[model samples]
Target: MHSDGNRKATIARHRVRLAACALLAAAAVLAGCERGSQIGAGESTGGPSGCPAVLAGAQAAVSRAEKKEVFWNGPTTGPAAAPGKTIVYVAQTMTNPGVAGAANGVREAARVIGWNVRVIDGGGTPAGIQAAMSQAVAVRPSGIVVGGFDPDSTSQQVSRADAAGIPLVGWHAVAAPGPSRRPELFTNVTTRVEDVAGISARWIIAHSHGRAGVVVITDASIPFARHKSDLIRKELATCSGVELLAYENIPIPDASSRTPQVIASLLSRFRSRWTHSVAINDLYFADAAAAFRAAGEKGSGPPFNIGAGDGDPSAFQRIDDRLYQAATVPEPLSQQGWQIVDEFNRAFSGRPASGYVAPVHITTAGNSDGATTWDPAGYREAYRRIWGK
Candidate 1:
């Protein structure tokens, strides 16, 4: 009898272990389902594959927010986003071609869907962006486009919009990670900094023969600067001939006095130890590229490979002239900008969220001569259908 009792207890324990294993397996499957993508413009709406993870760390908190809860700043009704009501978008800064392209995309979308859009320039400053948000609040627009505003300052404006039952969409970068008493933003759209950064890093590694040391002149002052730069560093590690010797962030409030001086110092340092440089953009990092070329010991590894961000024509010109090695082309802001507008309409209309992961194409010697267009006729048609005449 004793032997039989012991055997039964062992059998029961084995059954319990098997059940635990099954539960763990089920949880693993659920986790994969939860890891979703960005809700984009065209095609299927809100599917996992096509979504781009934008404003992830911050936006994650929104899911934990009370779905039925409302705030106390703006309106209680988002009739602008409601069916048959016009939706208006206001951009804080449409000065740069990139920004204007974004506005153009948004406006075109509004026209198709019979929505509305309004834009104001925040001048790319804290006060400037804040004022733009303020004006947007006063206009009581249907929706908002954060042209170049920081989150810390934009948070209050977002609160005001949220309270009024308006959905705020973000474009490009946010104000980095900070503690705010407000809910995380709901930017139907934002830039893909990491995607572009990875492309840029891969370019650097491939060009440098897989083994080289370089200086990273990243701009840390900008809220999203560290995030992009950090990703670049990680990707670079995977490349063969790349080592980030040192990274220095320049905070020059005075562009007049410090710009040249700062670049000059960076050049001096790179001249001594490393043979490469990577910067965040054309103008700022262009200064360093010029310095390194001038100071580089003659005939040292393809003139010390230097690259920057932005697909702007100026960066292309430098790449052509071979003054700069390469720069990522984040082009046709109009295409993606309008795509996000389409997203809001789809959600409000109860249509599936169309998703897209634009190809992260590289602009290199292979495609240098060819006319590279980021968005095409199909893009225009999509915009027209969403916000038509």
Candidate 2:
């Protein structure tokens, strides 16, 4: 009787184990089916595929005033420069076209107003930025504009400027989380990064018909790049038919050598599953398109690419040539330069700084036939008028 009872217990335990295994298998199958349903329901407006329509409506709702022509309307009197007053522009790096363009803008505006202006190159390093800031502080310029350098890195120099009654303005230096509220830093002039990401995502979704399998290329080293990447991820989340296969963060230091390998690996892993690629800027996506060509895996149809920030000439050429690059959102660098000087003028004149939002526009093959950057004719005229030039 005891042996029979023991044998029955063993059989009961075996039955329980089998039941558990069956339940596990069923759960796994259900999860996969749910994922597949989301992907296949491309026509459903309530699902991920519905993102394009939502984005379209939102974009259309942008105020007519905001979308209106870019123009300057600051204090008409402008700032009264102190005797022998000079303005200094500290650039993150002259190597970057955007930074260089900004430097030129400062010079142009200063020339119009007849104020002495100087620019210092920071060499794109923390130490270099600190050193440049130190040099500028020692000279005791009327005001200082810093391009693409983190405010925290040069806090000491910024404090010195503040103590000396010189206002400091930052361009592309502050990120989201809040405005430039630091006492030493007056204000930041920058494009709406969130809008740049949102518009680029919307473009991809609309062009791909919402069936986009996207691979995101992000640069974690730069705060603004990460900001753009984060916004892209958030915006794409609303699209049901869009699958995020991967988010690859490539540090700028190793980007030249690592990007190709990273792109090749993504191609190998996802194969033809992915239908689109988005990046922080044209720099990364342009290189990615080249990698696809070199690998001889350039497939025909619909998994195109897009990016944000500087509208590189090479990127425009690629778009015009019908390459994988589809579009780029260009932040008006020269306009920001003019705005930076304008803000400083207001501050010096004891008026509130005019926190200007730089204009951005999408450049594609159709619209950018011969344009590397958006034309600033209207804004330039407006600024000239305000300055009584």
Candidate 3:
């Protein structure tokens, strides 16, 4: 009787083990289904993409933005240049490549329009910018340019310029690309931030096959940039397979010094999980390149980087060389510069703002044609024709 009871007990234990094993096997199958690239009725499942439609949309948008040959779509008819006018371009910093590029465009347009232009470097500080604005107002130029900085930051100076009836045209001075009333800018020149932000995020989605561990870098100090980063984040969220690993806010001025350390810490933390990076500006990747190299990351990267704005010459070079950066949503810097001068001319003539916003374009080594800058075609001649120069 004792032997029979022991045998029965052993059979019971075997039954329990088999049941548990069956349950675990079932669970493993379910988990695999959750991560598998299988399409069910009205549902998509995949490690790379849980929403195949969203991924497809992103891929299509990226393809559209990556096309070359953006033609001049700016103002073809505007007031002829008010001759012999002197303008002061008060820049946030000459060190900012976008600001400097626009400044150069302004210089070139001024030459064409037979005007004198002077630039004051604000040195990217509040007090310094205020001082520069004060000097700008004191000199009483025909117009003042709020170059690559917020006009509201210098409200007093802006008010002074407004009171003095100095027309203020801005290059990325406000969120949108047209006249600003409260801040009293004649117009703000930039590609629509929504378009830029959308395309940049879509690039990551398409490139990664809808699955990416992304880190976003932005300067929260500037409202425009902060807004841009927010839009990028929102767009990226549409893809369920994409995981935003981190949102990093390093000021543009501090990027060079801080980005390397930040990259090192992030490398240690995320390691292989960190597969892509999107920056509001291209400079962050430029700063992070050496750190990535030190970490033994390939130049052709797992952490593929794309800049949302300000596709400077260096950014193009990085992309062309297949360095740490993969692509950029470039603002047509030279064309916008010419537009600024044209806008100022219209303001001088008491006409309405042109309302011409340049279409957004993306640049990669594949389509850059060995170009350092994404200078759109026909803007120079178009602006000259408008100014009757």
In terms of lDDT, which candidate is strongest?
Answer: 3
Model 3 spans with C-alpha error above 4 angstroms = 1-48
lDDT of 3 by residue, 200-255 (tens): 99888887777778999999988889999999999999988889999999988888
Q: How far is candidate 3 from the true structure (C-alpha RMSD, Å)?
A: 5.7
lDDT for each residue of candidate 2 in 177-255, tens digit (9 for 90 to 100): 2137663567787777887788777766665556668888877766777888989988887767678999999855456
Backbone clashes in model 2, listed as residue pairs: 48-239, 48-240, 49-240, 49-241, 275-303
Sequence-dependent TM-score of model 1: 0.64
Q: Residue 181 lDDT in model 1? A: 32
lDDT of 1 by residue, 182-220 (tens): 344444354466665665565555444444456665556
- The lDDT per prediction is 0.52, 0.69, 0.86
TM-score of model 3 vs. true structure: 0.88
Candidate 1: residue 203 Cα off by (Å): 1.5
Task: Please report, as a residue range, the 10-residue window in candidate 1 with the lowest summed lDDT.
Answer: 37-46
Worst 10 residues of 2 by lDDT: 36-45
Error of 2 at 230 (Å): 0.7
